[model samples]
Target: MTVRTRRLAALLAALSAFAAGCGGESDTDLVRDTVRSYGEASAKKDYQRICDDLVAKELLRSVEAVGLPCELAFKRGLQEVKNPRVEVGEVTVNKSKALVQVRSSAEGQPDSQDTLELTLEGGEWRISSLAKAQPQPPQPAAP
Candidate 1:
């Protein structure tokens, strides 16, 4: 075989090895994407779309827990707001569970941060919990 041909074969083998090593996206990435999609739907006031992304039990529980008031709030807030943006920050995953931090802003208001916990079930990611990002207390009103 020619020297050039052997070098080409070696390059192809290295490329294949790298590709195999990288494999596919991690579970954390999947959960992040799912949460982002849900947020986008919520921002659009597309309750049906948001509901479609949630697990059955979560959907039922959310409806019962918040009742119709939640739906009304979404409709009112989302409909009035234009160009909402949701940013998902660094996500950490352990085993089949993961935590994703998100920041959302609408119009020109301050960004709201929250964390979402997720689990991998049935080959899909589902939100298990959500906690609001608490702001640090303001410095004691200038002595």
Candidate 2:
């Protein structure tokens, strides 16, 4: 083979290796994705997925505070919210923790924003806490 052809083959191999390495999502991105999944599962009342996968085991206590199983509590929470659609926003990650901002809207209601706290547990990102975001003042009109 000509020298040019050999060089091209080497470049192609390198590019393939780089693409393979990029297949895994970063920790921040994983947290954002997990939050999205949690929202979808909650809206669908798929409590099993929420309790077993999306939420950290430590959060089970809060879910069971009402004397119900975690899955049952999740179901009740979803019913109260009603058809929630979550939009994930900026995400920040620390060593084993991540925070994701999300806006959720239910039918006939204004959007509610929350900050989700996630922890890297058992090789996966799982939500540990959720808190309402502080409302910001309206911005002035642009000149």
Candidate 3:
């Protein structure tokens, strides 16, 4: 093969390798993606999918503990909130656990921050718990 053809083949091979490596989602991205999917599902009122797939089994159990199934309970909670919005911020992943910072708001409600804890369960990232984000102490003013 000519030198030019060899160089072109090398470039193609390198590009293919890079593409393959990037095609799969990183753990951080997977965590963010799960949160984003939850937001979209919430907007569409897809409570079943959220309970059945997006959340961990333990969370689902808690949802059902009030004598209502997961889907019905979630639907009730969201009934008054219109245009629920969720924004995913910083994400930290350690082994099979992850913490995601999320900002959310809905009609007539103030914006709020929450932390979502996720675990790698059955090869999927699922939200295990959610709690209000703790307020950070004021940092000393920079010099």
Candidate 4:
């Protein structure tokens, strides 16, 4: 592994350890909290928190795979976003995995629907992946 990868792994491990003893939150709430927190962090441009506390290690690894650290990569992707808003809808949990429905909107942009996959890690819910829903086909105009 590269030095940056090692450092990121160490950072994640440390953060995980810090959260190892936290408990009492239901799976649904935990999953939703993670999503809401990620939205807040993204709006505030707090990429480090989003990388370390909100997202799964695998997602961070994907950023590193492209030769950039998680924070830089995630920030780059959101640079064009403004005044973001996140609304959590449905949350379904099965053991350590969960799926959360979200509606996201930003200034001058159309709202987007997405589902985020989360996993329980070190007693905390962490987002593993996010998939934007495909746009619905428009109906034909009536005669």
Candidate 5:
């Protein structure tokens, strides 16, 4: 092959590698998407969908430890609220673990904000635990 053709081929390969590394979405995006899906399911009161996205017993135990009444709360909350909206903000991903923040509002009232911890298992991101995000401390009065 001509030197010019070989150089062009090498350049294309390098560009492809770079694009795969930086241009395309990373695993963090996948985790964020999973978190969004969870919020959508909760807002829609789709318990099965939420369960499908969870990591089963292990995750459930963690959630329960934090006093999250998964089945009952989801059902009751869904029945009480109307037209819920969930906004996902801030995702931190480290290797196979991630934390996602979600703010949910129901019936035009701000409900509660939560952070969902997740992990990559069997090539799929699953919720490991759900915890209420602590509210920011009040700012001091200015002098």
Candidate 6:
């Protein structure tokens, strides 16, 4: 495992220990919280938190395979996003997997909505894949 992976694993372990009492939190709420945390961490350039608390191991592997650490990849990705904001929408869960619908928009850019896949690991949800959905066209108003 890479350094980022090890960090993330440790973070997850710590979270699991504390999350035992948070069983009352709904799945949607948990997913929403995770996305919100990601946004906050991104704004602060907290790459370690992003890797440990936001994305999954697979994502880390993909970044490392590309010859960049996950933290650097996250930083590079953030550069293209101006005034980034995210709103979590519907969350669909199936067993250990989940898909969170999110609407995100940046300055001078049209809204981009996507479904973020997540996995339940160590009693916490971690982002697995980010597949961007085609932007929906504006609907015409009816009389």
- TM-score: which candidate is best? 3
Off-target runs (Cα >4 Å) in candidate 5 are 1-24, 55-57, 61-73, 134-143
Distance from true location, Cα of 32 in model 5, Å: 1.4
Model 1 ranges off by over 4 Å: 1-23, 69-81, 135-143
Best by lDDT: 3
Cα lDDT for residue 49, candidate 3: 93
TM-score, predicted candidate 6 vs. hidden true structure = 0.75
User: What's each prediction's TM-score?
Assistant: 0.63, 0.76, 0.77, 0.76, 0.63, 0.75
How far does residue 39 in candidate 6 sit from its true spot (Å)? 2.2
For model 5 the TM-score comes to 0.63
Instruction: Tell me the lDDT of candidate 4.
Output: 0.87
Candidate 3 local accuracy as lDDT? Answer: 0.89
Between 1 and 5, whose lDDT is larger?
A: 5
- Candidate 5 lDDT score relative to the true structure: 0.75
Q: Give the TM-score of candidate 4.
A: 0.76
Backbone clashes in model 6, listed as residue pairs: none
Candidate 5: tens digits of C-alpha lDDT, residues 70-124: 6665576476767776677889989878888887666745467788888888888
Off by over 4 Å in 2: 1-20, 134-143
Report lDDT per candidate. 0.71, 0.86, 0.89, 0.87, 0.75, 0.83
- Superposed by TM-score, candidate 2 places the C-alpha of residue 104 at a distance from the truth, in angstroms, of 1.0
| Ranking 1 against 3 by TM-score, winner | 3
Order the numbered candidates by lDDT, best leading: 3, 4, 2, 6, 5, 1
Q: How far is candidate 4 from the true structure (C-alpha RMSD, Å)?
A: 14.1
Note the residue pairs that clash in candidate 3. none
lDDT of 3 by residue, 1-143 (tens): 99999999999999999999989989999999999999999999999899988999888888788899899998998878799999899999999999999988878777788999999999899999967665444448899
Query: By TM-score, is 2 or 3 better?
Result: 3
Which residue window of length 10 is worst by lDDT in model 5? 130-139
lDDT of 2 by residue, 1-143 (tens): 99999999999999999999889788877888899999889888899999999988778777788699998887776777778889999999999999888887777666777888998899999999967776444447799
